[model samples]
Target chain A: MANLKNNRYLKLFTSTFKLSACTFGGGFVIIPLMRKKFVQELEWIEEQEMLDLTAIAQSSPGAIAVNASILVGYHVAGVLGALVTVVGTVLPPLIIISIISLFYKAFRDNPIVSMAMAGMLCGVAAVIFDVVIDMAKVVFKKKRLLPLLVLIGAFIAVRFYAVNILIIILVCGVIGAIDTVVHEKKGAEVK
Target chain B: MIYLELFWSFFQIGLFSIGGGYAAMPLIQNQVVDVHPWLTMTQFADIMTIAEMTPGPIAINGATFVGIQVAGFPGAVIATLGCIFPSCVIVMTLAYIYYRYRGLNMVQGILAGLRPAVIAMIASAGISLLIMALYGQRSLPSDLKQFDAIALFISITAFIILRKFKPHPLWVMAGSGLAGIILYTLI
Candidate 1:
């Protein structure tokens, strides 16, 4: 039992570190990878928890990868687990950026390389679309009309008006809070 | 120097722009392309691809690429760090808050709003990429049929299949690559 517990911690540390190191394209890219590891590989967390963790990860601020590591870490081994996971995740960027601090001048306007990179953006966009469709299936399955409408509203805002998203986030947050409070009060009275 | 600006800008992207990577793109475009004009639209588009392909945050990769463009190595360093700083600070703060209000409704409600916004963000990201791609192909002769329709079609088809089948995504990826090669050769 003791050895197994120790192994979990070790596993947690290594995985989180690897996640942080290899999480290219921001934290969104890690979603599938994390699912494979936590839901399929280690089976430490259930599928629902992975789903729930994604929502929780996004609703809060900061990087998705960091928040995810913290949640998965804490879920696996408590506060210390969260600490190790976060440390592992952040370490690679720290080292890379530190090295980059010295030699930043040579990289700008490298045309041949930039052109190759252009070819890859299309692939990235396609992958991001895949993630969205997956999330949409989840949210829609709940029969959550209000959320569906809100997403449509946000889409219109971005597509048509090109509105600043921060404003929309604020508006939605306020509206959601009001609804929750009103519902809670109504339930209190009805009971 | 200018690298400092790139760092602070990306750090801001990392910190405040919530949701996820897709959500981060517009905010990045606003800063690097729209606000600063540090990079042309096509150049920025290419950097985005590089960012997506690499490990770590897409925004971080963008920061590094853009920062490198504006200033070089120091610029990339500053940009990458800047992009990361916001997330580091915000996530750490949230970690504290998450423990304090693990069961709070206010937190839950805020999340509720964000859920929809996130979907929207992701959708917009896809659209933005398409717009950029079409624009890139626009200047060519009208009859050229320049878009990589095959790649787009296959990628989406593969994604839908993977989603429906609930199999290993890597298999889908491998199959898509092979399919792509065959289609290209035949064409």
Candidate 2:
């Protein structure tokens, strides 16, 4: 809501860029880092806003980091903020990928590098696990049955039927929307 | 023509995919494997494996690797750009509207529904990863396939132990890589 240059835009942008470059696992890994810098250090955004944006970004499409940047940018200073945040987020991966590609053969099978990558993989799985658990507690509310059934359906589709993912998302979206609308109508009627 | 196709394909992936790269995995596999046939499923699986082993998001790696294979360096560039474009537009748009309607209950409620769905998708993915890791466990050939079980065990145990310890994740991964090498040579 203020002029970009005078405020903390540059600092926030650089911090996110570095996080993007360094973070191996996408989604949750980059998210906590972004929260640390934007929400915590600079106070650019609040905690609730971060959670809300995560929901929006997940549903919207595109790289989580990019969508997130746009949301944070939009929330912070409007159109210009969105532009700066995206540029900041893109710069890291763009630069790093270019460097990696240029030296691809040389680094492709380096043992130490390979070992480091192996470590990153374990960390990634753990990072994603943390995200799944934290969000599950909030969303599913420790439900005993319905959420478990939904989880079972998804696993069956992925493992047994080998169903197309888009189909799964479509079904879930429709079901979720119906549940939300019906519940809302019931609430309004009670009032 | 080639560059345009590369861009459009990833653009489509970006425009529709949510919950990040992991969620996009199945559709991406389809685009490259079934629809386009630019890469075989085996190669695609291998790419997924490598992507996991490397840095950055899964979709980005998919775009980069698939694009390079199809149309060389330029293809990778366009595809990556296409992949992130939707986020740029959508996030900025939402940010603008979110200000005026910050306290709308309906918006908040829709989010509540969507949250559970996203978690479900992540759960399914975790199961898929477990299956992949657990593959060699079931079909072990007495002594020949023991390495597979070891990796799985290390992954599971390291996952548990590392959760409590404050050491960097890279250390755990590097240790596994060493284990992979040692297992490979000795076994």
Candidate 3:
């Protein structure tokens, strides 16, 4: 950590801001760009650590973009790092969206714009479909039966029953905890 | 009143919307379109499309859009801040706990259990969005009572482009926009 130069705070803020400004699509789209910036360009973080952080960010609540920023920030400079990175990450969207909001009515009423939006929704949906496939491949790989059941159960609960998402997460978390404790006991008995 | 509601609603969304940006869509739909009377179904779709094209996360873009529509600039700030507030605190706390206890079996198990469910939620969200975009009444034709052939073509074209070249999504979206302008005008 000591190899880093002073003014690391400014560096962190600007670097994340740059990434946030440049990246187009949210979520998985930013991972490679982030690896390029933080791991390759600056050497601020190790490659393996970058992967680990990405995993943690995905699993944690909130936007992947925000979570990733916080992880990188916390890693590089601690709490201050996290704060600056969050600001950096959120600033671009705030600006762009605010500007759009000013012209919201004009954008909405224009037939040409509406047509373009219709086409864009199609494209966006397709892109999200790709994301679902990518995530499924990663999540299902080498997964055991219990985890698989949780996956299906969760989908059914949310998609059909319209169950609250937080409840599902909480229930699954508890089940996972129990699974771990039981496995530990088995291991101890065997030993 | 609207400002406070915007902040409070988005804060709830921020707290519970897990997985990623897309996972927040359904919850946002429920809050903005269903519970409150902020955006209509068509408007929600448009906001999502705009959010996709914009920089930063969709969730933030959504909050900003809804906030602005409701109460202007300050509303935008409040909603955006509220949306991100929970994330900052939660992630910071998790980052601390994660580093300390990452190797523990219990923590690992929790994540493992959670990962599959998260993936499922993402899938469910994606499918529902796709359905709404492609076949939902608002997206399709009204009198003709049929799918919009142009939109269908654009979706397939975009999917193929992404599949073959694996280009950045921005390119896919940009190409789709260009096609939309051209195709929709022509037909």
iRMSD in angstroms, per model: 5.1, 4.4, 4.4
Error of 1 at B110 (Å): 3.4
**For candidate 1, lDDT tens digit of each residue in A5-25?**
899889998887776664543
lDDT of 3 by residue, B141-185 (tens): 455456668878888888888778877665676677778889989
Q: Is candidate 1 or candidate 3 better by lDDT?
A: 3
* Every model's TM-score: 0.65, 0.67, 0.70
Of 1 and 3, the candidate ahead on DockQ is: 3
lDDT of 3 by residue, A95-187 (tens): 988898777657656888766666766776677666556556665676568878988999999788978677887888888899999999999
Steric clashes per prediction: 17, 2, 0
Which of the two candidates, 2 or 3, achieves a greater lDDT against the reference? 3
Ranking by DockQ: 3, 2, 1
Best by DockQ: 3
Residue B93's lDDT in candidate 1: 59
Cα distance off (Å), candidate 2, residue A1: 11
What tens-digit string does per-residue lDDT give for candidate 2 at A8-116? Answer: 5776577667766655645555665666577767898875566667656666777777777778777776677677777777666555555565565566667766554
lDDT of 2 at B148: 44
User: How much lDDT does each candidate structure score?
Assistant: 0.66, 0.64, 0.78
lDDT of 1 at A84: 77
